[model samples]
Target: MTETKELSRLKLLAKRYARANRIAQHQALDLVAGELGFPNWNKLISVSKKGWLADSVQMASIEAFVTRALPAAIFRDGDPEAMARRFAHLEQAERGMIGDHTYRLQEILHEVIIAGEGWSIRIPENPGAIPIVETFTNQERECPALEPEFLQKALELARDRAVQVRAEISADWPRRSTKPDQSGMVRHPLCRGESDVWFCLHCDGKITSAQIAQNLWHCPACGASPLDIFDTAFWSDDKGESFLPVKTDGSTDRDELDFRIVDSRPKLDLTEEKIILLIRSALLDDATNISEKLGALQAEISVDDENGVWIIIEEDLWPEGKDPVQALAVAKLLGLEVERLSSWSTIPFAWPRLGEIASSTCDYTQMMLDAYAQYGGSPTK
Candidate 1:
């Protein structure tokens, strides 16, 4: 039982490793087994059946091995320890003072998100893409990102997270796709096409193998994800021969942060459909009998461009001279002019007047069924 518990702990560690590195659980398990001096996970399990359990030191070693950035194929030196130390400064629950305001840093969905009281910044997975800084309030204050020190700190935190995310992405891809050869030739992970120059289907930009590798397979020209990049532009008739070269100047670096304030407050828009729905609900509130309720359900309501509501109530279900007071009050509240009209139409039941005479719908239904049986052939019809 103790051995089984140790094995379960190893499996949980493998799951965490798989999630962090964006690899399959089986692949992570094999890597874990390799770290523990086993050839593969199957071999490790076979050995575990012979009464083997991992000690605290061995478990810590396995965790440390799996915690490092995976594959090491993206780095020129192929050193995982150096890669781990590069982002070791950022803690799991990190917070810093950017000017007078405090900002909290967190990694969500492989993106670095730093949020403050009224503003938040999101650094996407693609390194070439610009960081999005959104402000909640509109007090006309100076943008915090415009400050040099604040922007630098935010960029540092974001870039570190981006590097880890890029490493994870590279680990999932083929080694040939991430690392180009001496002749600058690379393989497309999706199409298996090998070429020195690639084409982006999203923006029709021609990309060299080095440029794509530098951008982590994302299109530097349009900031499109790796899925949109292909070795050949199969969609084009000329195979992207006439395409322009993608300009990647300053894509990997940002000297200045663009500041833009967007208002994200809740806005209530009284569209035509919304106005009609509100008016119909008001008509339902005004209904006193089942016949009146059917009249409200069958009412044809429309809103004009001049903020006027037109409602046509059925004359047989609704009274002739009676006005819908609740509907008029609702229209007034919405600052709309109401035009109510009556029309004769076929109702669901034969005796529409019986609904008005009875107190409840059940009594009206039974009374209508008896009337239908006495006058017509059958109530089922």
Candidate 2:
């Protein structure tokens, strides 16, 4: 009975040792398999680095068999100290199969720490208290709810602030040049009826009439409205009119008088609303004649002698505090081409008062005013 009890105790100890050894070996295999991108030990044993059929299974199986047998053999035939040494050898062999790198152990430990109850700890209420490992674990599961009203309000405020900032950053454009030079008239090399035809200022094309009734004429090609025939030189094929002299031919300047109307009006298409907007904007302050104002505005907006006008809107003149939809409607009604400036703060123009800042520390209006004062009221020409 005593012998049977001792044999039973030995068997249980041997089984426990074998189970520990098996677990260690399995862990090592898992590490190697992960490194090689294999799903499990079976796949790892079957496949080689190049993925072709090799002696990997035979090699690993033989290694595992030898490793498992050695400890049992030492325990059965050798002293207690020899068995201990054999267990230590087996542990070293298992670790070697995985890797000798210190980082391997750290990685395994870190994964274990993250996966286990290490995540359930709570953060200390004391501000000065140092964080423990458990505080980090609890944070992973924390999902604090946000108030919908507060979030919506914040988003709206952010949107308004963004618009204000955009306005402040936009560029300031210089006044357009409106010079009545050679560029004002674009001449076509092709003449109408052997006479050089110049572009009519009113019709925006070549004129073809000799009769200047009421000092006004219309374009035949475009059928545009009539224009006033201003003091200018024109060519004609016929010799039967009265006007300025081309040369000092003392005989009543017959050649100049007989000049046929090649070109008549200036090419300016102005709408009533546009004229009003221009007047309101202080762009056309000095204008006894509507035509003169149109001419000047056209010239001021001209960048080159190309005889085209480009109207630019001052940043501050746009409705900042008003409804965006209404503002857009106003711009469209005025018949002005509006472009939203990207960087309003950098634009050369007066910064209009948008609204009072919610915070005293960040007063955007005040900042813009100071910047405008420093940069001067208008953009440099």
Expressed as tens digits, the lDDT of each residue in 117-225 for candidate 2 is 2221111211111122222223345311122342222222222222222212111111011011233332121212122222344433333222111011223333333
User: TM-score, each model?
Assistant: 0.63, 0.15
Q: Give the Å error, residue 77, model 1.
A: 18
Residue 367 accuracy (lDDT) in model 1:
93
For candidate 2, the lDDT comes to 0.30
Give candidate 1's error at residue 215 in angstroms: 2.4
Candidate No. with top TM-score: 1
Q: What are the per-residue Cα lDDT tens digits for candidate 1 across 17-102?
A: 66554445687798789778887899999988887788999999887765555322323243547455454544432687755867
Off by over 4 Å in 1: 1-89, 92-102, 138-152, 288-290, 346-381
Considering only N, C-alpha and C atoms within 3 Å, which residue pairs clash in candidate 1? none
RMSD of 1: 10.4
lDDT of every predicted structure (CA atoms): 0.76, 0.30
